[model samples]
Target: MKKILRVFAALAPLLLAACAPTQLVRNKGDAAALAQQAAREQKLANANHWVLEGKLGVSNGQDAGSGGFTWTQDGNHYEFVFRTPITGKSYRLTGSPDGAELDGADGGPQRGPDAEALMRRALHWEVPLDELRAWVLGLRAQGADAELSFGNDRLPSMLQQDGWTVTYPLWDTTRQPPLPAKVFAEKPPYKVKLAIQSWTMQ
Candidate 1:
């Protein structure tokens, strides 16, 4: 008995340390709940018409593109339009909830992933895009989950809820029928910044 007690005493510090609490690692359940809450908030914020404007910056390089956008959601269909620095072309794309190809600037069909996909591919950074658009439009994602948090900015900020830290900068205007300003996802590995300026509801 004395021998056993001595052995336990010698190991107590290691046992206590193994059970230490940590705040950095986010729980999956909690993260999902946060996403659901954010979806609810976003859907409520969605309207027929809203305006937005902001810049997108990258880490490895620098990119600033700002333009006006219009999204019309009818049933499960969505129509989007935008004008930016990357393309002088004003693209109007309409597609269904599922993977459907629409008018694309490259003379190709805009499909799964969509413009954001191309942007992510170009920037070489992985981001929660589907969630981003939903969040930007203030709607819930059709398939993927999301994360939302309030940030201190000239507008509102929503940090990632996916256990990954992707800080999104936003500005919520106090318009009867609330509206979202620019929603940005600033990533690391060269400092990536993607912004959706001016989102107007048709």
Candidate 2:
């Protein structure tokens, strides 16, 4: 009993340390510096291509859904595959700036002029797919005025743009260009949440 008590006493400190909250060392900065960082990162992302796998959730006043997705973006071309648990069906959307295509579980392929419009009409999900590419990269989409709030790490903690508010709560620091572990966006009747599991950059 004495030996067991001593072992437990020795482990207490280790256990406490393990349970302690992680201390984040921030990149302290002013607004200008934070904005500069955002711009730089955005430029970097746009110049390169990436593939991300994650879970995505969306909700509107009338409709709501969640799914797992694989997104691949190369220059101006992008391909997205979403698997929804609700219908146990997978949808594939591929597009460039010029046009978009969606293939449903029924194997019927639909093409359109705009991805978001097409999705709204076909899936009843109002998501700005094009703007999301920039949002996912921690940048504001073009053609919109953005208001940004920075976290301790000098990265965006919250952003308001184009009628949507996006929040970044988790980050992955292992990659050359660290990415968000979770991203949530809300715009009135529409909301989007993305929980990124992996990232591959080229």
Candidate 3:
């Protein structure tokens, strides 16, 4: 009985250790940095009214197009105009919470309840304008969970959310909150790139 008790006692600690819950150890510096990043993101999210002048490029593994664009946003309303240099043609997408409209396509003006659907139907482009609104301001989109990696400057270098990977290659640090100079997003077989030239914040 004594020998059996000794063996049982020796195995008890090993059993307990195996059943113990694992705890993740997070560094204090990393936690603080993440908190600061969250605060910055919140600030940018509040900036709903702004204008961005940039170049946009898109590819769908088969077809590709590039153009200069001006995006103006005021709360829930937005107007995006893209001008192709080669063809000297322009396309405009204007929308509010009520509805969305796409003009200057092959046929005529197309209206839909959603911007993404309208663009896809008229231009056959799979641009995610809803998420891009948040992303253009260096903020993450709502709804889905996102994974972020930071650059040496402590700004977001890359963000992964909603099946898309968006990268910020350059930042305009001269601005108060700092804006993205270049934003590139990809989901295999589809790619969208934006290069911002100027910003007008209202």
Candidate 4:
């Protein structure tokens, strides 16, 4: 009985911690400092190349799908791959300022002007690929106006950019340049969510 009581007591704090809200902002006054910190983080992200592996879910009002996702970004170039387990099929999309291309195992590469547009046509997923270049790095897309909301940890909790709203619920602090682990972004008629399992930076 005493041993059981002791065990319960020892686990109480952890249980509470797990239940506590992660997005609570205890110090609203820290917004400025947080913004500055975020800017520094963004700079680091933009000046370097990175890769992310994750699970992705997309919904477009009338349809929904999920798959394994991988993205590699270097300077102005990027390659995004998605594999759907059920169909045993993979899709690859590569893009740069020059243009975008989509290829599959059964078909030749198709070129398009924009990655997002290519995705909509090829995969029917309305992902905001251009804005995601910045959003994936926890920053608003360059040259676009945005509104940001910060959490207690002085990181972005939510961001409203262009026509989308992005939320950051978890950050992977273990990495050299901490990255977002779970990101959800949505706009009317389209929604996408990513749970990043790995991050590699160069």
Candidate 5:
């Protein structure tokens, strides 16, 4: 009886140890998957919102004021409409990344320094706009490569990616419920500033 008991006790520990790794792996995998899912949710939440309307202002060597601005991105094409309160004139601009074509809304021929610059300045907000899009809409941009973080509210800082950067504020958070409190591009001089007073996230 004693010998049989010892054999069973020894076998029990070996079985338990064998399962420890599997359980550990399973638990770890579940946790990792959850984190990824959360990141994805946040990304889509940021992008699915079809429109962003708020104020606009620029200060370069003492040029600044309040203006109305609307930004929208759909599929591969994006547009920005900036309205100056002082002038009450809004400029509507759009761009597309159709290979070398660089399509624009004005029915003009695409491709050139101007088109490239406009595209860069528009839809491709180097900040987590893509991630926001991903989080908000659950639509991942194929091989999109970006690292991200979050705050209890919209973050205020510069987002640097692939030699590019954009600065913006949390104008409004959602087609539903999330928004950037403030954001910035990694530019120079006023790269890290947030224009909060001139914004209404509706």
Candidate 6:
């Protein structure tokens, strides 16, 4: 009986340790920040009609290009124009829910079912225009899961979605609801950087 009691006493601590609940470490501020972000997103969701003027830089680990751009969005329709300073050439991409068209490429004009495919086929640029429209505004794109890290300002410091990592280094707080001033997105060899000069929201 003494030997059995010694063995049982030794196993008691192990059994209690195994039955103990696990402790979870969490940051209390994270929940508040996420709620703020959600509210911001809701406020900006209806801000679809706007014009953004900026400088765009794109690279594919080999070829690179930088140009001034004007993006005008009206609900489901959008028009994006790019002007190259060095080449003095201009390209315009316009589309709606129907289809997309890319004008002023190497060839005459290219038409496709979507902007992403049209851009890739016409300009050899691998940019996700559908997702970018939302990301440019510091909001996560629809139809995809995203992971966001908040900065000290409670704004998003980094956002990862659709296989791309986007970082907002600056924000225009002067606006009613702050907007991203500089949006940089990268996925491996492909990188797209935008330095927004001005924003006109309607």
Best by TM-score: 6
The reply for model 6, stretches above 4 Å from the true place, is: 1-29
| Candidate lDDT values, in order | 0.43, 0.72, 0.76, 0.72, 0.38, 0.79
The residue-by-residue lDDT of candidate 5 on 2-75, one tens digit each, is 23223233333332233221111112124444465466457554442266564443322222223455667666
RMSD of each: 17.5, 12.5, 19.9, 11.3, 23.5, 19.9
- lDDT-wise, the better of 1 and 2 is 2
Q: What does candidate 1's lDDT look like per residue over 1-202, in tens digits?
A: 1232232233333332332223222233355555554554665654434334444322333322233456556645656554433334454555554644445344355466454554444323244544555556544455546554443222224445344344433334554334454444444433323354455455
TM-score per model over all chains: 0.47, 0.78, 0.83, 0.80, 0.44, 0.84
Collision count for each candidate, in order: 25, 0, 0, 0, 25, 0
Give model 1's TM-score versus the native structure.
0.47
TM-score of 4: 0.80
| Rank by lDDT (best first) | 6, 3, 4, 2, 1, 5
Say which prediction, candidate 3 or candidate 4, comes out ahead on TM-score. Answer: 3
Candidate maximizing lDDT: 6
- Between 4 and 6, whose lDDT is larger? 6
Question: Candidate 6 at residue 31, lDDT?
Answer: 77
Where's the lowest-lDDT run of ten residues in candidate 5?
19-28
lDDT of 3 by residue, 91-191 (tens): 89999989999888867888999999997777656798999998888888999998887766677778889999888777899986788888888888877
Candidate 2 positional error at 52, Å: 0.5
* Candidate 4 structure lDDT: 0.72
Q: Compare candidates 3 and 5 on lDDT and give the better one.
A: 3
Better of 2 and 4 by lDDT: 4
